[model samples]
Target: MPLPDGNNFIEKFAKSFYNLFDTPATIIKEKIVAPNQKTYPWYHQKFRRVPTIDQCYTDDPICVFEADMQYRRDRQVDSEILSILRQRFEDCVLYETPDHMEKCKHLLQQYEEGSTDWFTKYGDLGAYHDVKVAYMKQKHRMVWERRHGPVGSGMKEN
Candidate 1:
């Protein structure tokens, strides 16, 4: 069905805006996963710990996996996808999993340029990757400074 007059503008705008956010990553995925793998590398288009059967996406092929093992226990963000990603990096620089944009730069640089030293600077723990992602997670989680007030809601103390 066709939208009529001004009513259609909102609907059209919404579709366009959604595309603007989802397009860049998908386009890059197509480029990087082509030839051997040519499908979306996204599972549900939302933040998830593991990719589902439906995602059918190949992991990023550019980064080289590491053989040495490094493990830490306190962190809860350590999903299998994260470990798999760890193996994909030469220096084990898998800062953000499930798509983390670098502040405002490439919006899709993935690893921190040639090195994974970014982890030493800012280890991941549901931190903001960019404005868009921050907005989305904040919108979804309604980020609070603490559970009741003081702390303990996965927030830092200060």
Candidate 2:
């Protein structure tokens, strides 16, 4: 269908003015090709830019915020793994009493190994980040599947 012709002076003038520009198609194409916030890493997504470690530590607010968020998440994962090992070690030590040093030695060693290993699991940030993001995606998928039943299953609600 043809668009309606502008009926008023201002509308006609605006329409004619905008029609003078012939770059809307290219503008739209550029927008479609641009890297959006969703494509960025979760931590620094707001700024749509990658910041170096030096920038993060040197008072760049966006970088600082991203670093802080990452630190907290890393600490949380570390704590979850370490706390379990720590609890087992403490329990073994508690029960062994006089022989705790010798009897609980293995548990102590495991705890230490776990604590150290957590940091070096993937040996690099890129691998660790990929795993962590994959885990989050899986967790969300599981939750959604639980609520709606598996994809392609006939039990989903409308």
Candidate 3:
């Protein structure tokens, strides 16, 4: 059958346009797999490698911020005694308005001592490095578990 005068060009153009986005048909083939062969389902993507923790990048702004934040968090946790003493001192000062100078003196002393002890223990580069290392280790584990399933689940590792 002959296409109408203008319909032929329009039909050809429309077909070509549609074909631009259409996926090409693939030929199906049969394959024989041995019993020992391992194959993943079609939906599964390529194998992913286990996550690794990299060293801290001091020059990078994002890395610097993360490292500093981690250090401060760990330091705060380890200095729980200092934080308690400081909070007590603040509470005393806030409660005793007029006699705070004398009434809160003991708390002030305790807070100062706690602060000194904390500084002596965890106020150095060694402490910061320790915190960063521990944080990175934890992040690596969490990322690996999230990407691949839990360890010992028989997941293939690349």
Candidate 4:
């Protein structure tokens, strides 16, 4: 649903920024192909030949408002989806979580259809990729421990 009075940016941005930066290594790609927020980060920051952001700031304002609103919605949706994926990744690491936790069919309907479930799991604020990697290492260590039975246990190999 559209914003009650009109679309707003900060409100929408707050709900989506976390998922926007999940891929720390490829922040630009993540922003460009944000799935929902497809507007290039460059688009916002780059100076435009047709009109400057300042020029467009208060011109009509509604159009700008709508555009900004759309941008926020897109980013929020993208971030929410990515966040769900991130959470699943973390869960997989800590709890040996399995794959295909849920299908996308239930996403907009179940997740952001006024649900916007990202708030509950938003903690430390930067654990997506790092948690995923650490989890991988955890599983690796578990496997190694089982095979070697401790590094200094004298389980020598020829």
Q: Which stretches of candidate 4 lie over 4 Å from their true place?
A: 1-58, 97-158
What clash count goes with each model?
1, 0, 0, 0
Q: Report the lDDT tens digits of candidate 4 across residue range 7-88.
A: 5887667656855765564776566556566356554544233432233455466655555444345545667677776565
Q: Write model 2 residue lDDT over 34-103, tens digit each, in one string.
A: 6442464555435324543344555567765665465555656687888999999999989889989999
On TM-score, the candidate that comes out on top is 3
Candidate 1 residue-wise lDDT at 112: 39
Candidate 3 global CA lDDT score = 0.65
How many pairs in model 4 have backbone atoms within 3 A of each other, for residues 3 or more apart or on separate chains, i.e. clashes? 0
Higher-lDDT candidate among 1 and 4?
4
* Predicted structure 4: lDDT: 0.50
Give the Cα error of residue 103 in candidate 4, in Å: 19
Tens-digit lDDT track of model 3 for 18-51 = 7665634211122333444667778644444322
Once fitted onto the true fold, the runs of candidate 3 whose alpha carbons sit more than 4 angstroms away are 1-77, 131-158
lDDT of each: 0.41, 0.66, 0.65, 0.50
Candidates by TM-score, descending order: 3, 2, 4, 1
| Per-residue error (Å), model 3, residue 104 | 0.5
lDDT of 1 by residue, 1-158 (tens): 87676588778899889999899988887777565663567763333233222232335322111100111211223444345444555232255543443332342233334124334322443443432332343344433533434223455546
Pairs that clash in candidate 2: none
